[model samples]
Target: MKHALILVALLGLSVTAVAQTVREPDGYRMDQYRGPVPDSLTGGRVLDPEAAHDLWQAGEAAFIDVLPRAPKPKNLPEGTIWRDKPRHSIPGAIWLPNVGYGAIAEVTADYFRRGLEQATDGNMDHPVVIFCLAECWMSWNAAKRALEYGYSEVYWMPDGTDGWTFFDYPTEVITPEPEP
Candidate 1:
């Protein structure tokens, strides 16, 4: 038991160090999110792909994809066929668009809070992982929001889904339902 506890503590420290050292990729804009992000969220930690994969395989976390759903392009001369690009994410990640990606509106915030409650069955201690595209701020905002909502184990996957797939991690296609 002591050894396990020690190992966990060391991992926590390592994650913190990694988070602090992470630099935003070139061309990342702060104006993108237009929301405050603290240096750290008390119980939330930043995770690399390996750490995220471990949690995923172990079923120890709820993975959330905060990437916004692409809007259908406007303007068609007549009948130009439009097809969506393939939608894929780390296996089992829930697609929760609009949960983050700028200052969250009140309605969307309420919806996200409720959805999160249902997702975790109201268990605040359930581990939750939030992610989006590499260098995207959406995942950062969502992860911080989860922490603010009292989730004890929030993980921000800064490397995003593409990073996971880049490493040859298995991915699953997810078809999001149309919102009413």
Candidate 2:
């Protein structure tokens, strides 16, 4: 029992020690003393800002933004809310909203298959990046769905829209696309 306690203590200490070394992109060093990342969900890969940018520029990776709803597009006029993810997407990404807010399970395999079809409409396999509102699970579910669909390269960036903008990547806010 004592050994377990000691191990736990050391584990906590190490996380703190490593966190001190993290640096924000703005040249300001992140504080060494910290708690946990606020509202973080696990089981998905996390990515740094620049890496996200590079993958985007290469076009080898597709970006999908998972949002609940927003102002209707100019054409829609009446506007609409979406339960499944839209296809409008994050520039290169095809929108695929997996789970809604506070969902326990990831999105269904069909959701990913559809997204995969878009990602590989021409290519069978390709690198794909999924994300959602910062500190949200919509992206995690979306990414997992990709894996279930047999995608070899799937990245989940929980940083979401906030993180993307934080790093200053170009984003277009568009109305959701009707699924075909």
Best-performing candidate as measured by lDDT: 1
CA lDDT of each prediction against the hidden true structure: 0.74, 0.55
In terms of lDDT, model 2 sits at 0.55
Worst 10 residues of 1 by lDDT: 22-31
Q: Estimate each model's TM-score.
A: 0.73, 0.59
lDDT of 2 by residue, 147-173 (tens): 655666767775666777886677775
In model 1, where do residues sit more than 4 Å from their true spots? Answer: 1-30, 33-42, 74-78, 177-180
TM-score for candidate 1 = 0.73
Query: Which residue pairs in candidate 2 have backbone atoms (N, alpha carbon, C) closer than 3 angstroms, thus clashing?
Result: 20-32, 63-93, 85-97
Cα deviation in Å at residue 73, candidate 1? 3.1
